[model samples]
Every structure is written in structure tokens, then in C-alpha cells.
Target: MPVLVKDYTWSETDTEVLITVPLKGVKPSKADIFSSEDYVKINYTPYLFEVFLYAPVVEEESSIRVGNGVVEMRLCKKEKVIWGQLESNIKMDKEEMRRKREDVVKAVQEKMEQEQMERATKKREAEKLAIKQQMQLEEEAHSKIEKEKQDERDKAMEELEEWKQHKQEETKTTSITNKPTIQPAQLKQQQNSKLSHNMWQDNKDIPDSQRPAPRSGGKITVNFTPRYFPTAARESTEKEEQEWLAKMAAARKIQAGTPSEINKNNPMLLKDKACGFFKAGDYEAAINAFSQAISLNPMLPVLYSNRAACYLKLNDNEKCIQDATRALELLYPVVPSNHIQRAKVFVRRGTAYANIGNHGLALQDYEAAEKLDPDNTQLQTDIVQIRNLISCDS
Candidate 1:
């Protein structure tokens, strides 16, 4: 229904008998009023005035109506109006039609532009989500590949370890079959040089002056010879067996007390544990464990000697000498029965004494160890060096 009509201007330089239609709560659409040809038709005719209208202002409580020489009009969802009769044939008012068309056109163009912006925003969001999913998938694949590689490495290491154990067993069996049971001292002396000093092998053939100086002092000199034991005679066999058993015991002690496994079952376990710690290159741990072990079992000379070794490794000569002196006090009297053990403690203590510049005490320990174990290569070597030092000092 027609509501009100008012005069309006489409442009500053253009005028017409104008009409505006108010939609109230309803917005007017271009599809309801105009066609595709209307825009082309409007652009070609400048005689018709242009018009601008807004989207329906539904929230406004009141409406407006005004009339000048130009006519302003209002229309609702339910209304249509007729303009005053055209001046020519029964025809449309070009100005009135243009005004109506332009209003609808502007609204449609704005709506299309808004829809395009929303579409572009949705597309960008989708692209970002796709990139995030792809990255997550790649990370999962990489993690799986890494797990597989690590599994392969672990399997290879296990197989290699098993093969090594098999070879070691075969070597042990072959060596046992080829060699008869030998005297422990004879076997030990031969093996000790290889285990205790690899450097000696390289320089063993070299003359005295050509060899490096002994770390304790004086010159380095060594002598080696193979000795035969009587395996046929019963007394000789018993002596050989006893000597062999002692050598085996010593070997077991050395192996068991290595840094990898300290014999906790033994009273000397704590000391051995400390020695192990020192071999593992953790001097502080070795020292503390050794001290604790000594506290736990003070009567054992081995514990004191072992702790002394740790102190020596740490370059704490005073503590080393103290431990060695303690070991000597406990061990010296029993040398007739336990010469090898006493000799080892003496040599170690003497080394500590030498480090502190007490040549006399160092010499004394060296001499004592030598007297107890006259055939011990290590003790003999040490005695020769002490004698050389005495000669040099004199």
C-alpha cells in the first residue's frame, strides 16, 4: 500500500519528480524490481537522474515523509504506487525507473562483495588446516622411521655380542687342549708382564739407555726366561698344583674386582668396589667407597692397600702413604706364609712413599717386598730401580 510521498534529489545537478519506498522491516531486492538489461539501459541514459537508497532500517521506531516540487515516496512489503501520468505515450518514467533500479543495484553489489569476502576467509582457514594436518602426518612418519632404525641397531649389537661370546669359548677350549697344567707362579709371571705392561713389549728388546725411565725414578730394565716344572714326580706335581691354584686365585681376584663388577660377597668388596670406581675413572666415588669399606673391615690389609691405590690414583700421596703404612703394619709379620700379598702391599706403599720424596722409606718397602718374593718379576724390577736411585743419590 502507498504510505507517503515526498520530493527528492538524485544528484546535485539533476532533478526529477522522485519517489522513495520504505520497506519497514523488509529489505527491497533487485530481483523483485530490476533485470540484467536494466544496468546497461541505465548507463546509456543520462537524461534520467541517479538515485541512492539504504538497506531497510528495521530497528528505527519512526518513518519519514516529505514533499517538495519533487515527489518523495514510500512503499512497504505490501505497497506499489503510480506516478503522475507520463508526458508522452503510456510509458515508464525513465527517471523514476532509474531511481528504483539504482537502489536495488547498489544493495545487490554490496551483498555480492560481502559474500566474496566471507568465501575468501573460509578458503584461507581451510588451507591453514590442511597444512597443519600434513605437518602432523610427516612427523608421525619420521617418528616411525626413527624407531625402526633404532630397533635394527639394537638387533645388530645383540647378534655381534653373541658371536663374540661363541668365539671366546672356542679359543678357551683350544688353549686348554694344547697346554698341560703348569706351575701358577711360572704362568703368572709370564702373563703378568703382558697384562701389567703392554709398553714393555714394544721396548723389551731395546737396551737400558734406550728404554724410558721408570716412573718411580732411576732406569727401566727387565729380564724374562721360561722355566720348566717337574710335572711327572708326585711332590713336584703337588707343588705345581698349589702354585697353579694360587695363580688362579690371584687372577680371579683381579678379574672379580675390576670396575665392572666388585665382589660384594667378599669382606674386601668395598675396597674392591673403590678400586673398580678408580678404574672407571671416578676417583671421588672410588675414594669414598674405599674409605667406607675400610671402616667396615679394618683388619684386612687388602682393603687398606686397595684404598691406597685409589688415593695414589687421585695423587693424594699423604693418604696413600697412610693407607699403605696401615696395610704394611698388618701384613709384614705374616710374610713367610703370605709373601706375595705382603710384597704387593709393600710395592704399592713404597710407590706412595716415593711420590712424597721419602726415598729411604720407599727403599725400605721395596727391599722388604723383594726379600719376601725373590722371584717376583715386578718386585725384582722395583728393587733394581731402588738400587739405581740409591747409587744416583750417593
Candidate 2:
């Protein structure tokens, strides 16, 4: 649609021209004004106004103002002379107005094309950047995969070398074992003959006091004899067995009453003792104490968990998992089921699985623990590490 030109009035002085348009409620900033030395154009929404000046004006010295629902412009004249009229004498007929409108439309179209070109350039650059980032990420992933494969190859080579060395040692052992054996009596005879020969050769150097005395007739006598012993009487065996059986029975009676007497029906004391042993790095003793405590109170989940920790310290991964699982099972359907204690059990089980090289199961348990306690940074780190291990294994 063609814009409606708004009515405007203008007055001129010796050095300036003042133009005013009544807007009623519109702000002057809403108008777009294009000014030059000979022509001026004012455009607002649904309104376009233009005029040819009577003479050239200083375009840079023009000013616009808006107040009281009125928009005004002050155009400073280049020459200090009064203008006969606000506009030029040349009339703007229909053809000239159409030409001016077409010129304005062309200028606006050129500006819009320039802006669109700039936007297209920015978009292409952004896409290129995104593609570059994706390629970088892919390269990093490929490098990581290659590194893991190399590590596996190196590990395999090490294991193969170890096996080869072990086989070589076994071969040496077998060869040694296949050699002929000497009888003890022959070996003793050889040693005695060697000793006699050496003694005869060194007889002249021997001291008289250290040497064996010789008979005056130069005759030697030798004797070989076997030792004999008296057999034992059979009467003492029955009495010894009877005394041993009595002592064992008494020990069993004491053992049966010791736990009840020392613990006095309190399992916490046993738990404390187990913890003390654990703190002292005596895992075997700690495990025994924990087992005893668990036997005393089967429902104590902490006992099982503590025992699982001890098992882990001992490198018994299967027992660790079993005890951790038992602890979790005992803790269920209670207030502590989803508490930090239960989460710790899951972490313990996960650690055991990790130690046994079961990355998938370890990841699962770590994730479960993470859900129970999301703020645990260590658990999160463990989960990521296990995931990486699983991926590498695959």
C-alpha cells in the first residue's frame, strides 16, 4: 500500500528553516529522516513526506525535536539569506513523486541486501566452527582408542614373556630331576676313602697328639655292628588318651560359655572390638571378630558391611561382595535402607567388583550408590573411571 503523506508546515529565516508536523501522540524517534543539501525525506509508519529545498542547506547542522505531540526539524542554511518559500519553485508532479519513491525503495533494497549478505557470512562461519569442533572431538576419541589398544598389546606381550620364562625354568627343573641318583652308602664310602687317602698323604705333617696311635706290630682291626633298642610297653597309651579327652571336653565347655559371659548379650561391644582390629590393620582378626558379632546378632547390617571391608582389605573379592550383599539385604525395609550406610555398602560391593575386573557390575553398583547419594564426588569419579574401563575393554 502507498504511504499517506502527513501534513507539515515550514517557515524560513535568514539563516535557518523550521519545519513542524503535528503527531498528536507519536514520538519523534519513531520517524526516520533522510536529509541532504537539496532534498529531505521524513518517513513514519504509514506516512512518508519529502520536500526539495529552495537552496542548499548545511545538512550536518540540522536538528530535530519532539514535544507536546509535535515533531519539528530546524535546518540551517548554508548561505545567510532569507528564502522566499520553504521549498523550491520546481513543482513535484505525479511522475517526479513516483521516481523519488522508486529511488527510495531501491536504496532501502540495497541496504537490506548488504545486511543479508553479512548474516549469511556469519552463519557459514558458525557452521564451519561447529564442524571443526566435531572433528577435533572425533580425533581425540580416536587417539584414546588407539592408546588403549596399544596398552592391551603391551600387556599381552608382557604376559607372554612371563609364560615363556616360566616354561624355561620348568624345563631346567625337569632336566635336573632326570639325572641319576647315588645311594647313601656308596656316597659315604667315597667320602671315607677320600679322607683316608688325604690322611695317608699328610701323615708326615700330622702332630702326634692329634693323630690316631698306631700299633707296634702295624696290624689294623676293624669291626661293623648295628645298634639295638628295647621295645616299649603298651600300657601307657590308654591313660594318655583318657587325660587328653577330659581336657578337650573341659575346653569346649569353657568355649561355649565365653561369648555369652564376655558380651553379656550386647553385640555393639563386639562390633567395637572388630572396628578396633580393623583400625589396627589386623584384617584377619577383624574379620573373625566381625563374624563372631554377626553370629551373635544376625540382623546387624553394619557387622556385615564391616566384615566386607575387611575381606576387601584381604583381597578376597568374592567374600567381600557376599558380605556387602548380605548387608544390603539385611538393611532393606528399614529407615536406613536408602541412607548413607546402605550407599556405603553398594560402594564397597562396587569396589570389590572393580578389584575382580568386573567393570560392568562395578559400574552398575557405583551408579546405584550415586543415586542414593548424588553429592558424593568420589562415587561420581568412580563411576566415570569404571565407565572408561568398560569402554576400553569393549
TM-score of each: 0.32, 0.34
| Residues 1-394 of candidate 2: C-alpha lDDT, one tens digit per residue | 5365557888888999999877645456455566666677766665777777779888678887766767788999999998888776554577776675566445544554455456656876998998798778777767776776677666655654565577567657777667556678656665554455353334464322222222123222332221112214553344544443454344333322254465433455556666656654457877987888766677667889999999987779999999999888766642322368888999999989988999888888889888888999988887888988998999
lDDT of 1 by residue, 1-394 (tens): 2322123222211212223433333312110122121121111111222233222212122223432322233222111333332122312466866666566455544454455456656876998998798778777767776776677666655654565577568667777567555577656555653554354555454322222222222232332222234344543545545664554355335422344543343345455455545544456877787676655556666777877877776668888888888877765335134677778788877887877778788989888888888887877887678778878888
Global lDDT of model 1 = 0.53
**Whole-model lDDT for model 2 versus the true structure?**
0.69
The C-alpha stretches of model 1 lying farther than 4 A from their native spots are 1-267
TM-score of 2: 0.34
lDDT of each: 0.53, 0.69
